[model samples]
Target: MKVIFIRHSEPDYSMLDKAQNPQAYVEFGRDLAPLTARGRLLAQEAAQNPLLDEAEVIISSSITRALETAFYMARHRAINLLVEPFFHEWRPDLDGLNYTEVELALAHQTYMVNDGNLPSDSPIRYETGAEVKARFLLALKKYCQYETVAVVTHGMLMRQFVPLDHIDYCQFVTCDIDL
Candidate 1:
C-alpha cells in the first residue's frame, strides 16, 4: 500500500497585518481561509505530478484549502475525493499578545521539531504530541488499506503523518512502508 501526504499550497495572510488588537489576531489564526492565487497554481502543478496522477484514491482535510486542492486533482482524474477532518491543520492559539513574525515562525519550528507540542505558556488548546500522533497514525492505517491514495492536507499534518522512513518536501514522495 502507498499513501501520499500532500501539503496544501500557500495561504494569503495579508489581512493578518490589519489585526490591531490581540483578540483579532487570535481570531484570524482560527479563521479558515481559501488559497491565494499562487496556492491554486501550486496545487495545479501538484496535480500534474506523475505520481499524483497515478493515485487510485484521493483524500483531503475538510478545510477549504485542502478541499480546493483535492477538487483540482479530482477534476483531472476521475476519482471520489474523501474529506478527513483529522488531517486538518494543527491550529494552536497564541498568547493573547499579537504574534511577531519571528514569534510565529519560531512557533512553527517548535511544533515541527517538538511533534506538534508547545510550551505551556502558549495560548493554544495545546493538544499533546501523543494526541496528534495517535490520530495521524490511525488515519494512516485507515487510509493505507487501499493500494494507492493521495492525502491533501496542511504542512503540520503532513509532517505528523508522513512516514519517517522517507521525508522529502521538495515534491511528491512515495514510500513502501506503512510507517
Candidate 2:
C-alpha cells in the first residue's frame, strides 16, 4: 500500500521572538485552533500537489492544526475524511507556565534535543519520543490496510519518523513499508 504523510502548515508562533517558547505545544490540550491566514494559504498550495489529486483516503491527527490542514485538502478534493487521535501531536504536561514562558522553554529544548523521554514524575501526561514513534508506526500499519492514505499531522511527529533536512512547514512524503 502507498501512504502519504503530510506535515501541518506553519503555526502562529512560527515567527515568535527568540524569548518565546515554541515547543510549549508539547503540553497543549485538545483544542481545535484554526489556521492563521498565511497557514490557510500554505495549506492551499500544499493541496494543489499533483500526487494529492490521486489520494484515496484522507486521515488526520485530532489536533486542530493537523485537522485543519487535512480539512483544507479534503475540501479541495471533495473527499471524505477521518480523524485519528493515535495520530495526534505528542501531548506533554507543562503546568503553571504562562504562554510566554512556554515558548521560551521550548526554544532551548528544540535545538538541543532530538527526542525526549519525559520524566516519570511529570505532572502532565506526556509521551516519550519512543512512544510517539511506536504509535505512529502502529497507526501507519493500521491505515495501510486500505489502498492509499494521506496523513496530516504535526511537523515534529513527521521529524521523529522521516528524515527531512529542511522540514516542510506543510509538506508531503510518500513511502511503502511492510511494517
Candidate 3:
C-alpha cells in the first residue's frame, strides 16, 4: 500500500483565549482549531503539487486543520475525501489540572523520540507507539485498493511512520507497506 501523509498547516490557536469557556477550550478545543490565513494559503499552494496528481482518494484526520487542508486539495482534483479517526493526532491525557502546556510539549517529544513510552512520572499517559502504528496501518490497508491515498494528518501522528525528525506544516511524505 502507498500512502502520502501530509501534515496540516499552522492552526489559529488564539481562538481558545476568546472562547466563552476557556477551561472547555483547554479540554477539547485543540481538535477543533482551524488553520490560520497563511495556513490556508499554504494548503492552496500545496494542492497543486504534482505529488498529488495520482491520488485516487484523499483521507484525512477528523480534526478541522487536516480536514480543511484535505478540502482544498480535493476540491480541485474532484477526488473522494474520507475522514478516518485512526489518522488523528496522538492525544495527551488532558486532565486539565494535572499537566502544564510545557509538560504537554515535552511529553509529546518524549513519545515521538522514545517510540511512545513516557517517563514513569509523566503526567500524560498517551497512547503507546505500538497503538499508533497499528491504527495508521489499518487506515493504509483500508485504502490500499486505491492506487494512491493522500492522507492529511498531524505531525506527531505521522512521526510514527514517517522517517523524519521534523514534519512541518503542509509537509508531506510518502510511504509503502505490503498488505
Candidate 4:
C-alpha cells in the first residue's frame, strides 16, 4: 500500500488569540483554527496533484484546518474522507491558560531536554516522537485494505515519523508500506 502523508496548509492562529474563551481555546478550541485565505487557495492548488488522484481513501486529522484541506483535496472525487483523532497534531502539554510563542518554545525546550519524560510529580511532560509514530502506525493498520491512502495532518506530527529536513504547508511525502 502507498501512504501519502500531507501536511495541512497554514492555519490562522490569530483566531485562537482573538477567541473570546482563551481557556477553551487552550483546551480543545485550538483544534478549531481554520486555514487562512492563502492557505485555502494553496491547498486547493496542491489538490490538483495527480498523485492524489490515485488515493482510494482520504484520512484527515479531526482538526478543522486538516478537515478543510481534506475537503479541497477530495474536491469532486468520490473517495471517502475519514476523520480520525490519531492523525491530529502533536499536542503539547500546556497549562489551562493563555500562552505566548516564547513560553511555548521554552516549554518545548524543557520537554526535549528531559527526553519526553519527567519526574512522576512533574507537570511538564510531552509526547515523544516514538509515541507519536506508534499511534500513526496503528492508524494505518486500521485501513490496510486501501491501496492508496492520503492523510492530511499537521507538520509536527509528520516530522515524528517522516525523515525530512522540513515539511511546509501542503507538502506531501509518499511512502510504500506493506500491511
Candidate 5:
C-alpha cells in the first residue's frame, strides 16, 4: 500500500493575538481557523501534483484547516473526502489550557525526554508521542486495502508517524507501507 501524507495549509494566526483568554482563543482557533488566501492557492496547486492523481481514497482530520486542504485534493481527484478524528493533531494538554508556542516546544522536548511517558503530574492531558504513533499506525492498518491513500493531517501528527524533517504547508510526501 502507499500512503501519501499531506500537511494542512497555512492557518490565519493573526486573531490569536487579539483574544483576551489564551486558552479560549486556542480552543476556538482549533475548531475555526481557516486558511489564508495564499494557503488556498497552495492547496489548489498541491492538488495538481501527479502523485495525488493516483489516490484511490482521501482521508482527512476533521479540523477545519485540514478539511479545507482535503477539499482541494478530493475535488481535483473527484473522490469523496473521508473525515477521521483519529488523524487530529496531538494535544499535550487535556484541560484546554493556553500554551504559548514556546511552551509547546518545551513540552515536546519534555515529552521526548520522558520517551513519551506522561508524568504523573502532567498538567496537559494529551496523548504521548508513542500513543500518537500507535493510533496512527492502527488507522493506517484499517485503511490498508486502498492502493493509494491520501491522508490530510497536521505536521505534528505526521512527524509522529514518519521521519519528516520539515513539512511546509500544503506539502505532501509519499511513503510505501508494507501492509
Candidate 6:
C-alpha cells in the first residue's frame, strides 16, 4: 500500500488576537483555524502535483484547516473526502485551560525531550508522542486495503510517525507499506 501524508496548509492566526479570552482562543483555534489565501493557493498547487495523481482515496483530519487542505485534492480527483477524528492533532489540555504559546511550546519540547514520558505532575491531559504514533499506525492498518491513499493531518501528529525536523504547510511525505 502507498500512503501519502499531507500536513494542513498555513493557518490564519489573525482572529486569535481579537479573541476576548486567550484560553478560549486556543481551544477554538484548534478546530477553527482556516487557511490563509496563500494556503489555498498552495493547496491548489498541491492538487496538481503528480504525486497525488494516483491517489485512489483521500482522508483528512476533522480539523477545519486539514479539511480545507484536503478539499482541493479530493475535488481535483473527484473522490469523496473521509473525515477522521483520529488524525487530529494531540490536545494537551482537556480541561480547556488557557495556555500561552510559550507554555505550549515548552510542553511540546519537554514531551519530545523526555521521549513522551511526561512528568506525573503535569496538569495537561494529552496523548504522549508514542501514543500518537500507535494510533496513527492503527489508522494505517485500517486503510491498508487501499492501493493508494492520501491522508491530510496535522504536523504534530505526522512528526510522531515520520522522521522530519519540520513539516511545512501542505508538504507531504510518501511511504510504501507492506500490508
Flag clash pairs in model 4: none
Cα misplacement distance, residue 1 of candidate 5 (Å): 2.2
Q: TM-score of predicted model 2?
A: 0.73
Candidate 4 residue lDDT tens string, 1-179: 89898999988878788768665575356778899999999898988888888899899999999999998888746578999888987646645444445555655676556655444665554566677777788887999888889999987677765677579999989888765
How far is 73's C-alpha from truth in model 3 (Å)?
0.2
**Model 6 lowest lDDT segment of ten:** 21-30
Model 3 global lDDT (CA atoms, 0 to 1): 0.81
lDDT of each: 0.66, 0.70, 0.81, 0.78, 0.80, 0.81
TM-score of each: 0.71, 0.73, 0.88, 0.84, 0.82, 0.87
Q: After superposition, how far is residue 3 of candidate 4 from its true place, in Å?
A: 0.6
- The candidate with the higher TM-score, 3 or 6, is 3
**Candidate with best TM-score:** 3
lDDT of 6 by residue, 27-69 (tens): 5465787889999999988887777877888999988899999
State the weakest 10-residue window (summed lDDT) of model 1: 161-170
lDDT of 5 by residue, 1-179 (tens): 88889999988766655667545655436557778899899999999988887789899998889999999889988997899888888876656666766666777777767766788887655668788877777777878678889999988788775776678998888877675
Q: State the TM-score for model 4.
A: 0.84
Q: Please, what are the lDDT tens digits per residue for candidate 3 over residues 1-179? A: 67888999888888876888655664346778899999999999999878898778899999999999999999978888999887988766635454556766776787866767766876567777677788788776777678778999988778778667889899979987677
Better of 2 and 3 by lDDT: 3
Model 2 weakest lDDT span, ten residues long: 22-31
Query: What clash pairs does model 2 have?
Result: 20-103, 20-104, 21-103, 21-104
Where model 1 places Cα greater than 4 Å from the true spot, the runs are 15-31, 94-125, 161-170, 177-179
Q: Estimate the TM-score for candidate 5.
A: 0.82
